[model samples]
Target: MIIQPKQRNIAYRCPECASSIFGIVGKFALSADMLRLKCSCDKGSALDINKTNDGKIRLSVPCLFCKQNHSYVVSESVFFDRDKFLLNCPYTGMDIAFIGDEQTVNSELARTEEEIRRLMAGFEAEDISELQPEDMNEDEILPDPAVYDTLRFLVKDLEAEGKLECLCNEGSYELRFCDGGVQVYCERCGATYTFGATTPALAEEYLNIDYLKLK
Candidate 1:
């Protein structure tokens, strides 16, 4: 006997670019069916349709890397037949992250959101005046404006204290950006220091250090 599969409409949004893609998918095609959905912006996601142990349909989606929040949408049979579908960042060709099941995914998402809220509360309690710029001085060369400004100010502060000098104390240094990070090297003593913002979140933490004591 041959049984015809069911069809449903599923929509996806990129996590990074927030671009949307929609398509009609089969409900009972196979246990592990993957449909590649690419947004017009070039980023995409592979929607995997699988059957749970309890004979339920499952959809696995990849999330974005840059964004802090994970997004999802739920539709009755037309979209996913379930409560929700995993979302991915649209800037990249593929989703940057994937979790096992929906239950675990929701739990993880709640934890992540709560952590972000707590961190924001902590940041709000701190004196952020020093971190804020009074004037507009933007450097297009640096990937992160905050890091560039902070390092520039740190150098000026160290120079005023005569501590920006290399180990020889008479050597001069040069700062440059490379491989998405900043590097400082001395011409006379060959002393070098590098600050990298490998991820967006780590950029500020890297710039918040005392660079004068790198002897």
Candidate 2:
């Protein structure tokens, strides 16, 4: 008879691009000095797992909400024995990383995404009249906040599904908002995709985009 090694699913939202990253960690891997899980954005956003000499586990997590990296340490048993474990950002109380069975990790990620959408919608409901004249920069024309947020959400969703790409295969993409539209550009190779985001109709049209290639 053979005993299978214990394994756990891990997931985190990238601080740089807000894309969900998923991976699996095996019990044997914990025996090593360190393990790193990186996001596809290739922007230095990653989760690090380190094994201490005292037989404990150390986790370095990147938080999408706080835009920060947080560190925590726990016993080996707590790290590997739990059916579900979540690490959250202290500032926002937002879950930064998830470790557990595949189903639970995926469910938590979906819930988090839905919660963020609702929060953004709530912000959009605020009165536009509340903005003071001092808040406007005469020389800077900003894009519609709601439209920009929608574009950002769509871009991250595409990124998570591996549907966003760049002409230069090695380059990773990032999103930028302009006066009337949004841009998806590769940081390394300068490949770009620009499209209008001045209206909800334009943003909704992108929902049908199954793949995007920056050139």
Candidate 3:
């Protein structure tokens, strides 16, 4: 007889790139203080797992629907004993992460993607340009909430590290939200760095940037 280690597959969508992230978690993996599951996108987004002194598992999950990180604590049985478990965004009620048997998780993900495609098809038929009033300026349009929030968080982190600067040698900067992206500009020199955030791929790419140079 052979003994198999207790393990379960985990899956989630990259909050920055909207790409599916998959991994496996073993019962022994939690022996450490922390376990991190990072996306292959290399966008700095990851799922952190911590075991509490009380034998509870704490999960820090990143959400694309609400542009926020959510934390949940569960018993060890709930984490490893379930055949399938799903974590959803509280605000949108959309599944943000999955943990269970590999086949179940993969099937659910495919169904979710199909639903999204159907919704997008309907959205494409509408004339979005006509919905906006002709008198409305481009600046009046609100940026995508997920993209805007991600950029804002990145900017704050960069500023804290003293990596955000302008050619004029000024560290003070401001953000301007436009239709498809946001602009970081120097308050004193007016130098600017414009980045696209219209798509998840673009946003994920920007997340890799460590320093911002306004020119």
Top model by lDDT, which number? Answer: 2
List model 1 lDDT by residue over 1-215, tens digit each. Answer: 74432554455445535444455565555445544555556444444555546454445553433332222222223233323333333222123332323454445456554644465466673322322234423233225534443443355445445666577767644454556566655657878677665444565575455546434
Candidate 1: misplaced stretches above 4 Å?
A: 1-142, 198-201, 206-208, 211-215
Model 1, global lDDT? 0.45
Ranking by TM-score: 2, 3, 1
List where candidate 3 sits over 4 angstroms from the true fold.
1-5, 119-215
Q: What lDDT does model 2 reach?
A: 0.69
What is the C-alpha lDDT profile of model 2 across 1-215, one tens digit per residue? 75443888999987666788998887787787588999877586889888878776777787675455666665565567666777655334456688888999999899888876676576673322222123443225444444544555566557656788887667655555554577767768898888777776788788788888888
Q: Model 3 compared with the native: what TM-score?
A: 0.53
- For model 2, give the 10-residue run with minimal summed lDDT: 125-134
What residue runs in model 2 are displaced by over 4 Å at the alpha carbon? Answer: 1-5, 125-215
lDDT of 3: 0.67
RMSD of 2: 17.2
